[model samples]
Target chain A: MNAVIVENIIKTYGKKKEVTALNDISFDVSQGELFGIIGPDGAGKTSLFRILTTLLLADSGKAMVDGYDVVKDYKAIRKRVGYMPGRFSLYPDLSVEENLNFFATIFNTSIKENYDLIKHIYVQIEPFKDRKAGKLSGGMKQKLALSCALIHRPSVLFLDEPTTGVDAVSRKEFWEMLKTLKEQGITILVSTPYMDEAGLCDRVALIQNGKILSINTPRGIVDSFSKPLWAVKSSRMLPLLKELLQEDFVEDAYPFGEFHHVVMKDQSDEPLLRQFIEDHNNDSAVLQAARPDIEDCFIALMKN
Target chain B: MRTLKFILRKEFRQIFRDPGILRVILIMPAIQLLILPWAADYEIKNIKLAVVDHDHSEYSRQLINKVTSSGYFILTHYSSSYEQALEEIEKDDADLVLQIPDHFEKDLVRENEARLFMALNAINGTKANLGGAYLRTIIQDYNRQVRTEWIQFPRFSSETQIEITSSNWFNPLMNYKYFMVPGILVILLTMVGSNLAAINIVKEKEIGTIEQINVTPIKKFHFVLGKLLPFWILGLVVLTIGLTIARLAYGIIPAGSFLTIYVFAAVYLLAVLGLGLLISTYSVNQQQAMLLSFFLMMIFILLGGLYTSIDSMPEWAKWITRFNPVSYFIEVMRMVVLKGSSLADIKYHLLKMAGFAVVFNGWAIFSYHKRS
Candidate 1:
């Protein structure tokens, strides 16, 4: 059964509807599935999370969480779902233990009751249980927030951009925690702007401008890029990108890290492109046949 | 009930952890209560008098001596011309001028009547009015003295006299602190109660913790009560400190029972804290909440009849006092502290304050939405 379902959700902000925060958005998440909503900043990912968490009302639509209607059975849904806002919303003045204990008691449960669920994450920060949450480093704060969100043993969890400001190593550890939580049969819905994190999710919905562009497994999204792609790097990268975009057979080219990823319009051979680049550049250019990643598929789908 | 307890625990922990809040709650009241009453004294003194003694007579000299000795006036300038006295007034040296005409004591002996002219700067209406009244009283007494000296044999004289005696009730000494301390106590409690409660919720909103609380299954009533009761208790704590200061520092033992004041204060706090919560719900951040509460508090305190009597206010302003909860609490404070009024006497104020509590809390709860 589906753990969450959203249908035709439309939300607009401002008196004159000047900003469309969520525009007719729709998606669903199955039980125990690790779902990712990948988008850049201001793509209405937080708005969607707020709607599902019952902290906001959509302009018009229907959503259900754990078989309870979001509007009609909000109380029941609130009891079973956990939400971690995009910002660190825990009380900064509260110590780590006090913050966790407070959330646990308010949910009508004790910390020991759900000790097994958050033990791995809690043990790391246990030494600083008396330290105020505000003074903790960014990664420690994220861990505490996750622990607080999970203290009640929620059936479905919604984390909005949990890794946005966290460091690289902490971001990897946070995702691994999510993997363990999923192993315990908890369905998690996490949103991040990091394209690489998309591959770690069971399935992802690539959203932009409040509209979902594509929802598929990361491998499925990369496999759907039905064009030959090549990565070309030269000493002069900017000029090489401009020259590659000017090619008649080249469908698209964007500067991706050190190399320019060029999408061919047809099934063209790699050496032909290599020879063409060597003709333009006096001699120092390396070209290789490359496979598309989620970012590449995202750019391809966005362009279409 | 359990949720409320946990919320209260968290709130108290936060309140105690922040030294800024602790200082505002505990030390601010002690300092304000100790210092405000002395500065807010209503008895005016040191009225600078520029005397234009044109008469130069025995009676005039006697009158000048009497006025100068009264403790209210200071002889700033002794001038022979009214113009000099006027110059003194223009320079802001003298507050009032007494110009005795050229009588020479002849009109008092032959005509039995004399006139003296007095001119006051009148820039400060209260000081000018009181100074003029004091001078007139002194002159009246001197006139009676001269009449009695002329009529040496009072038993044979046919002149009739009326005597009046008055006594100040409740406060025999007419102590200004007794009148001011109770009112100031009420003001301090109002300020602390409303401002703390106002900032507490908005602080949560500012730091984004309120959104996390809203998504929980906790009822709105429980959440608001959790936010309110801690500040409500703090409000009462401030009142206790203020009352102790009033007794120990100012020697003002309330004429009424302490129970009456506590009963009234309990209801008054509900109304004030409700107002704070209402302001918080309407505001989006701590700064906005603080600014709005400060604006409302200024209006409430100024019109509250603590500094100014409501009876003397303009008709429109009097209407505002009727709606001001601060006015009701101040009146109740004075009634209990000065008049020794009991709970039975202040039932009307108690009922009105309860009504304010209902309206404010109801509106606050209605406007505060779990989902927006």
Candidate 2:
């Protein structure tokens, strides 16, 4: 059975129906697979996590986790699955060990029983075992939270934006820890707004405005981007962007850090685009063809 | 039960680890009990007086001596004119102006009647009324004394006299502290119990920690129980400290069984904690919880008959007190402590408290949703 099976979930907020937080959303995660729901902020990712974890009710639809219905068998589902919310939700006043032991004991288990599962992560922060969770650094807190969520050895783990605010190195280490957990045959469903992290997942569903734009393997989504994309940079990046968007052949131009990612209507129009920017800028601009990444695919899908 | 144990353990750990909360839980009630009773004393004393005597007769001098020696009033101004006495009152120097009129003794001796005019500053009506009543009683006693001494013949036959002898039962000294300490103890315990429990869940919500606990397999009843039990234990500790202070500091001991007091307190705490937990469940944040709890506590303390007797309350207020858990507990505390009321004597209150406990806690558990 699929670790998670959600069909046509719809959720809305407010008495006047001013916000449709989740709209006809559906997807499934395979057992022991690392699936990702990638989207920008307010993409209804947290809402979906809340619904699947049995912490919320979908306005209309059904969800099953670990072969149990979310509404009817919430108790059974609760025992089988672990959920780390988008924010660090552990007690700030309690020490790291206390938080872990509390979560473990509430699930009718002990830290010793789950020692083999969380030991790898727990050992890293064990030196500061008595330190309060609030005092821990962001990366340490993330690990401690993940350990608490996994204390019961849940069959499936749901991490909502686990790497949102961590430093780059810690973010990389966190993903490595997820890979380790996935290797141990725990189905993991993680959500993040970071587009680069999407490539790390086995399969991803791009969501926006409470709707899923596409669901595919990372490579599959990247391969489906048929537009000719290029990165263009100039001495005057701001003016170059304004000039690129005004051109007829330039399909889209958005500032992407050091370079502006420009998509052309035709691959043959790249030389013309470069010449046009050089003429407009008066001198000193560079343009080169760039392979489309997941971000490019996401922007293309959003545009379509 | 195991889940409850873990939850309670975590709650206690959090409570004790924070030294500020620990002090509030343990020490604040003791200080309040020790100090609040003295401030809330209702026995009116020290009526500042300005005596205006227009009559210069020997009887007037005697009456002035009588009023000055009464100990209840201080002769702030022994003025010869009513205007002078009124000036002292306007200056806020005198609470009452006792004007003994001319022929104060001649009319009393010839016609067996005399008149005294009292102009009181009644800004604080209770103080003014009590001071007025005290002066009236003293004057009547002085009048009787004068009649017996001045009249050689008997004013009336002894058989016609009705001597009413009365005793103040329960508190023979009419000590206001004795009356107030038990009531104040109830207020302290209620504040500690309700406010602490009111903030428990809401603090978790504010810190974002409640979401982690909600996804666990813990039952709703267990969650509410866990939230209540730690504060319940702390409240009982507060009650014990308050009672100890009441005994050592204020020299008060329950005339009835301490067991009876504990039995009542145990049940009363459930209702209080339940009400608090219910507030926490309804409030979206800690500030809201604090404000709502303060509002309820204000209503509960005022209507609980701590300062005002329920017998003196209007019929509708008395009806509301029937539903007030604080009223039942305060009444029970006073009955057992001062009146030495036995368990069977207070069975009605105990049963009502048991009913409150069941209803409030049941409603609290039912209203709390883990999936919301």
Candidate 3:
């Protein structure tokens, strides 16, 4: 059986239907699978997580976590599932040790009972156990939060943007931690706006405007891009983009850190695109053909 | 039950760790108890008086001296004209104008009765009424004195006179502090209980930690109980300190048993704390919770008969006070402390408070949404 199932969840807000936060959302995450819901801000990621965690009621639909219905079996679901919200939701005035011990006690367990699950993360923060949780650095807080969530030995863990504000190195280490947790046969459903983090998941669902755009493996998503894409650069990057969009074969062009990612009509060749950019700009201009990535696929899906 | 224990433990740890809230809970009530009763005293003294002694007789002069010596009035004006005395009252310089008619003693000796006119500034009706009543008692005493010395009839001496001697029960000296101390203590307990309880849950919401607890398996009733128990215990502690200060500073001990006060307080705390939790559940943040609690508290205290008598209130206001939990507690405190009334005397009050506890907590638990 799947660890999490969300079937046709719909949610709206405002008295006049001013916002539709979620629209006909449906997905399933298998047991022990690492599922990623990738979207930008206002893409209804938090709303979906709240619905599945039983914090909010969906306007219409059904969801089940740990084989228990989100509504009817909320008490049973609450015991077996662990949820870390998008924000750091622990007591700030409490010490790190106190926070962890309090959460463990409330779950009717002790720290010694699940020390193996959190030993690696707790070791990094154990030295500052006396300091208040609010005084700790961002990376330490993230690790401490993860330790608290996993201390209960839950069968399914839900992390909502766990690494949104951490440093790059900490983000990498956090994803590594998630991978280890996944290996221990705990199904994980994590959401983030960062496209690079999608590569760390086994499968990802691209969501935008409260609707699911596509759900596939990161490699599969990039491989499915059916346009001739290339990276174009010139001495004046702004002018190159302006001149490229005026071309008849240019489908879309966007700046992707030092180079501009250019997508042309299917029949257009890379050689013709390179020649077009070189003739319109200075001699310092350069063009190179490159493989598409997850970001490219997201942008393509959003455009379609 | 185990979940409730853990939650209560967490609440206690958080409360004790923050030194600011700790001082507010433990020490502030003591200071307020010592200071507030002295300020809230309703005993009217040093009322400004203006007298128009038209007769200028020995009787009028004697009456003026008697009024000033009563210790309740300060002779601010001694005008010979009633118009001038009225001016003093109109200027807000005097609270009362005493008028002695011409030939006041001659008319009394000849006709056996005379009239005296007194004008009072009734804007502050309580002070005015009390001052007028004091003046009337003093004049009556003077009348009885004059009639005894001036009238020398052998037949009157043999006739009988009805002498009435009255004793003030509970408070023989009529000390205002005794009346005010217990009432103020009730307010202090309610303020601390409701403010702390109302802000407790909303602070968790503001910090985003409520979602973590809400998604857990802990029952909603357990959560509400956990939030209320800590403040309930703290309120009892505050009450103990307040009672100590009342005894040490104001010399007030409950005439009744401590058991009576505790029984009433425990029930009162449940009602008050439940009200506070209900406010927190509806508010979105700590500031909103504080403001909402403050608003409700103002209404509750004013209508609770702390500073005013419920019997003296208007028909509509008295109806509102019937539903106010603070009013019942105040009545219980007065009955047990001042009147030294036993449990049987306050049985009706205890039942009302118990009813309030059940209804307020039931509404709080019902309104608290565990799912959405």
| lDDT (10s digit) by residue, model 2, range B1-372 | 778888888889989888978899777887788778888887777889999888878988888788779888888998779998999888989999999888988888898899999989898798799989988888888888997898675566655667688899999999999989999889888887788888878988888888888899988878888888888888888888888888899789899999999988998998898888888889999899999999888888889998888899999999998889999988999999999999999999999999998888888888888886
Model 1 per-residue lDDT tens digits across residues B71-156: 99999999689999999999999999988878748788888888888898888998899889988988888888887788576575
Give candidate 3 misplaced runs (Cα > 4 Å): A15-18, A267-279, B52-59, B78-91, B99-117, B143-149, B153-165
Superposed model 2: Cα runs more than 4 Å off: B109-112, B155-163
Among residues 3 or more apart in sequence or in different chains, the pairs in candidate 2 whose N, CA or C atoms overlap within 3 Å are none
Which of 1 and 3 is ahead in DockQ?
Answer: 1
lDDT of 2 at A123: 94
TM-score for the B chain of model 3: 0.92
* Per-candidate alpha-carbon RMSD to the true structure: 2.1, 1.9, 2.7
lDDT of 3 by residue, B190-236 (tens): 97778888888899899999999888878888888899999999899
Could you give the CAPRI-style class of model 2?
Answer: high
What are the per-residue Cα lDDT tens digits for candidate 2 across A1-304? 6999999999999998789999998898889999999999999999999998999998999999989999999999889889999888999888999999999999999999989999889999999999999999999999999999999999999999999999999999999999999989999999999999999999999999999999999999999988899998878988888878898998998988788999999988877986786678655677777888998889888998
lDDT of each: 0.91, 0.89, 0.90
Evaluation by DockQ, superior candidate among 1 and 2 = 2
User: Candidate 2 chain A: worst 10 consecutive residues by lDDT?
Assistant: A277-286
